[model samples]
Target: MKFISWNVNGFRALQRKMDVFAWLQETGADAFCIQETKLHQDQVQFDTPGYFQYWNDAVRKGYSGTAIVTKNEPLNVTYGMGIEEHDQEGRLITLEYENYFLITVYTPNAKRDLTRLGYRLEWGAAFTKYIKGLDQIKPVIFCGDLNVAHQEIDLTYPKNNNGNSGFTQQERDDFTTLLDNGFVDSYRSLYPEQTGAYSWWSFQFNARQRNIGWRIDYFVTSERLKRKIVDARILRDVIGSDHCPVELELSEYYGRHAGR
Candidate 1:
């Protein structure tokens, strides 16, 4: 099975520039998850013929949001973490399949000067607890723009960027706690020594052109599903937003070890 995750940055803006449906078809993914949609259900209209679309739109218009377009319908779909404090921005969506739970999250970004850093950390703790609960029931496949670099190798000039919003010590430690709780960072697990493999780039100073980017987007699976992951990749060539898509391919029909 194939799955792809991308942070469109702004769904409407991307649609105006390129054919999203055509691109989605070309990938032939069983599921495609997106973050930073920046749209509410009423703000835009998009459809995929064979896919079941699920959306979690922020209460605040033109802000953070998430969605999943999957060919396979989920048994259940959940929006947000169920905490009143955390659900307002519509940052998470959980789709429960027969074998596993698929979660797409748009983690809160710590604003410039670390203004939102405290809230970001709180959200991380709540998110970790939520995913851990799912892990107990079944292995989970979670992906999206987590908004943190996690390590020095994850971004260009990490030394200079250290303590910045996305590379802060607090954020990285929170990410560590999540991984310690039985999840595998799929891409890093596959290419631990690989560098310049980034998914999100800044629009400033021609950052994307220079490949000065951060590997903040991710596909993390329960450690038990490690063997089933055939490939995890950064799709740097495909473009519409500042971030490109990331992909994961799993062995076919591994039902027993697959979904929930």
Candidate 2:
């Protein structure tokens, strides 16, 4: 099975900039999970013929939102973590297939001033619990913009950016905690020591041109699915938003017939 996850920044903006449907056809992924859609469902009229679409729009118009377009229809679709406070932003969506649960999440940012750090941490803990619960039932594959660089190796200049919103010790520790709870970061699992591979770049100071970026986007799965991960790639060359798409290819053997 193949999947592509991207923080498109904004779906409408991306569509206006390029042919999104053509791009989707070009990728040929079984599923395309998107974050930061920044629009309500009715606002956009995107027609993807071969894919089923699921969208979770934020209460606030043109703000935080998520969507998934998939060639295979899920057995069930769930929006949010069942927590009202955290659900308002439409930051999460879970699709249940015959074998596993796939989730797309847009983790809240700590903000430039770190004002939302406390709330971000709170959300992190709640998110951890939510995914863990799903893991207990079946292996989970979750991907999207996690909004934090997990370690010093994840970003361009760790020392220089230390304590910043996405690089803070607390935020990083929270990510570690999530991985510690029976999950694996698929890309790191594949390329443990690989460097200069990134998913998101700053729009300022020619960061993308200089390749000064962070691997805040990811495809994470239950530890049991680690071996099935055929390839996890950061498609740095693909451009539409400040963030690029991360692709994950799983062994075809682990499809519907794969037992829990």
Candidate 3:
């Protein structure tokens, strides 16, 4: 099974630039997750015949949101973490398959002045606990814009970005805690030494043109599902968003383990 994740920045804006239907047709992905949709469901006009579409829109207009499009129907679908404090922005969605649960999240960003840092950190802890609980039931595959570059190698100028919003030490440590618990960073596990590979780039300073970016997006799987990961990719060439798509291919072993 192939799962792809991308933070579209704004679904509405992308539609004006490219035909998303045509783009999805070209990839042939089993499931695709998008973050920062920035629009309500009524505002989205997508018509993918065979795919099941699920969306979680923020209460605040033109803000954080997420969605998942899958060819295979899930056994159960859920939105948010069920924690009132974290459910407001419509930042999370979970799809339960027979063998595993696939979740997409758009983590709260710490503002440039670090005004939202405290809230972001609290959200991270709650999110980690939520995923851990799901893991106790079945393996989990979580993806989308996490908004933090875990390591120095994840961004173009780590040294210069030490205390920056997305590259702060506190945020990075929270990411480490998730891995230490049981989840595996699928991309890094597969390409440990690969550098200059990133998912999100700043629109300012001609960043994308210069390949200056940060890999704040990810596909993280429970340790039990690690071996099923066949490949992970950073699709930097694909356009339509400030962030590119990241994909994970799983072996047929997962298919055979269905209905577990």
Candidate 4:
């Protein structure tokens, strides 16, 4: 099975800019998950054939949201982590299959001045706890704009960007704790020393063209599913948002008919 994750920034805006459905067909992904849709349920309509659409929209219109378009129908779909505070943003969605729970999340960003850092940390802890609990039942495959540059190698000019939002030591350490618990960062695990591989770039200063960016998006899975991950890729060439799409291909080990 193959999964694709991208932060479209805004769904309606992308629709007007390019052929969204055509691009989706080009990927040929079994499941296409998107973050930061920035729209309400009634705001946009997508006619996606050969796929099932599930959306989690924020309480506020034109704000943080997520959605998944999957070829296979999930056994169950959940909108959030059941936390009222966290659910308000529509930042999370979980799809339950026979073998695993697939999640897409748009982690909150700490403002430039760090005013939201405290809330960001709180959300991280709650998110960690939520996934760990799900992992206890079955394996988990979660991906999205994690909003943290995990390690020095994850971003360009780490020294100059230190202490900055998304590159802060505290945020990085919190990410470490998540991996330490039981998840594996799929891309980094496969390409340990890969440099100049980033998913997000600043719109200003020609950052994307110069390849000055940070890899804050990821495909993470339960440690047990590591061996099943065939490939993790950053589709840098595909342009729609500040962050490009990331792909993860899995072997046929845990599909709809796996345990049968």
lDDT of 4 by residue, 1-260 (tens): 89999999999988888898888888889999999999987889899988999999999999999999999898999999999988999999999998899999999999899999999999999999999999999999999999999989999999999999999999999999999999999999999999999999999999999999999999999998888889999999988899999999989766645545
What residue pairs clash in candidate 1, if any at all?
A: 98-260, 99-259, 99-260, 100-259, 100-260
lDDT against true structure, model 1: 0.92
Residue-level lDDT tens digits of model 1 in 1-260: 88999999899999998889889999989899999999997888797898899999999999999999999999999999899999999899999988889999999999988999999999999999999999999889999999999889999989999899999999999999999999999999999999998998889999999999999999999999899899999999988999999998878866444543
> Among these predicted structures, which one has the highest lDDT?
2
Weakest 10 consecutive residues of candidate 2 by summed lDDT = 251-260
Q: Please give, for residues 1-260, the per-residue lDDT of candidate 3 as tens digits.
A: 89999999899999998999788878989899999999999987899998999999999999999999999999999999999999999999999988899999999999999999999999999999999999999899999999999999999999999999999999999999999889999999999989999998989998999999999999999998888899999999998899999999998878677545
RMSD of 1: 1.3
Q: After superposition, how far is residue 22 of candidate 4 from its true place, in Å?
A: 1.7
Off by over 4 Å in 2: none
Q: How accurate is candidate 2 locally (lDDT)?
A: 0.95
Ranking by lDDT: 2, 3, 4, 1
Model 2: per-residue Cα lDDT over 1-260, one tens digit each: 89999999999999988998888899889999999999999999999997999999999999999999999999999999999999999999999988899999999999999999999999999999999999999899999999999988899999999999999999999999999999999999999999998999989999999999999999999999998999999999888999999999999999756794
Better lDDT candidate (2, 3)? 2
Error in Å for residue 95 of model 3: 0.5
